[model samples]
Target: MAGRGEMPMRPARPGPPMQYRGPPPMARARVEPIDREKTCPLLLRVFTKVGGHHQNEEFAVRGKEPKDEVQIYTWKDATLRELTDLVKEVALAARKRNARLSFAFVYPDKHGRFVVKEVGSTFSYGHGRGDDAKSLAELGFQIGDYLSVAIY
Candidate 1:
């Protein structure tokens, strides 16, 4: 029998663990890819250009001219992030306008129906952080008729 600390090396030694030559994995993937060209889901839900037509001033007084709504549908799978990004994008696009314009962060109701917050600026209507109706509603333009959400 082997005594304490004496003649205990009966088994042969094994080689050291192999070195991992491969590169370390990316740092937890990117936090979020910055897709400059990518538009979010909500952009599809845009339903702007509701009920208007290019007509002469003389024709408007007669009320005989047919009007059309440049309507759009609600983006079906608009995530909050996508919606917010789209709203901001639209607002930026409005830069060409002489006056500041409005956009809405339109969403659905509790009963699963779509609803528009107001026809105002995104600044005063949908602040995009949960509840910012005032900033959102401040939007002065309607994206679409209440019903004609341009289906993406």
Candidate 2:
């Protein structure tokens, strides 16, 4: 109440209005749906090659693999367009029609080495949509993993 100055008003800085949390919403792990006639079919073990992939130092030896093996019993919900149509029935160069497979996942790491790991790519006919619907337990595939395809 001074008669010649008027300078007194400072009290308004108390909490609530600074939000920007950012980083807590990535749960996603609800995969359950495999009962292909009571399940029981996992022997993937594929290894074809024609133009690329096949060099994690050639799986760094363990019985010298990479002679174009193909032994799929499949069913981890198998998809990559159903393993690219079971590797075009047996890889007649992936059945042409502008072939392009390219999928990997050799596995072994933890000092055992032999880690290919690609995980997706498809097209031997078309209309299969993205990584051909990805499966084999959604591409984390681990059961002696070893798929390696790559048939441009």
- Output the number of the TM-score-best candidate: 2
Candidate 1: tens digits of C-alpha lDDT, residues 1-152? 78888886576668887888899765532223334346342223243332221222312233342242222333432233333344444444333323223334344446654444433332212335432333211222233223222111
* C-alpha TM-score for every candidate: 0.25, 0.30
Query: How many pairs of residues collide in each model?
Result: 27, 0
Q: What is candidate 2's lDDT per residue for 52-116, written digit by digit as tens?
A: 88988887887898888888897877789988988899879889988888899998889998889
Candidate 1 lands at a TM-score of 0.25
Q: Score residue 105 of candidate 2 by CA lDDT.
A: 90
Candidate 1 contains a number of clashing pairs equal to: 27
Error of 1 at 70 (Å): 7.1
In model 2, the clashing pairs are none
Alpha carbon lDDT of each predicted model: 0.34, 0.84
Those runs of model 2 whose alpha carbons end farther than 4 Å from true positions after fitting are 1-50, 58-97, 106-108, 117-121, 129-131, 135-137, 141-151
> Which residues of candidate 1, in runs, are more than 4 Å off?
1-33, 36-43, 50-97, 118-152
- The C-alpha local distance difference test score for the whole of candidate 1 amounts to 0.34
The candidate 2 region of ten consecutive residues with least summed lDDT is: 1-10
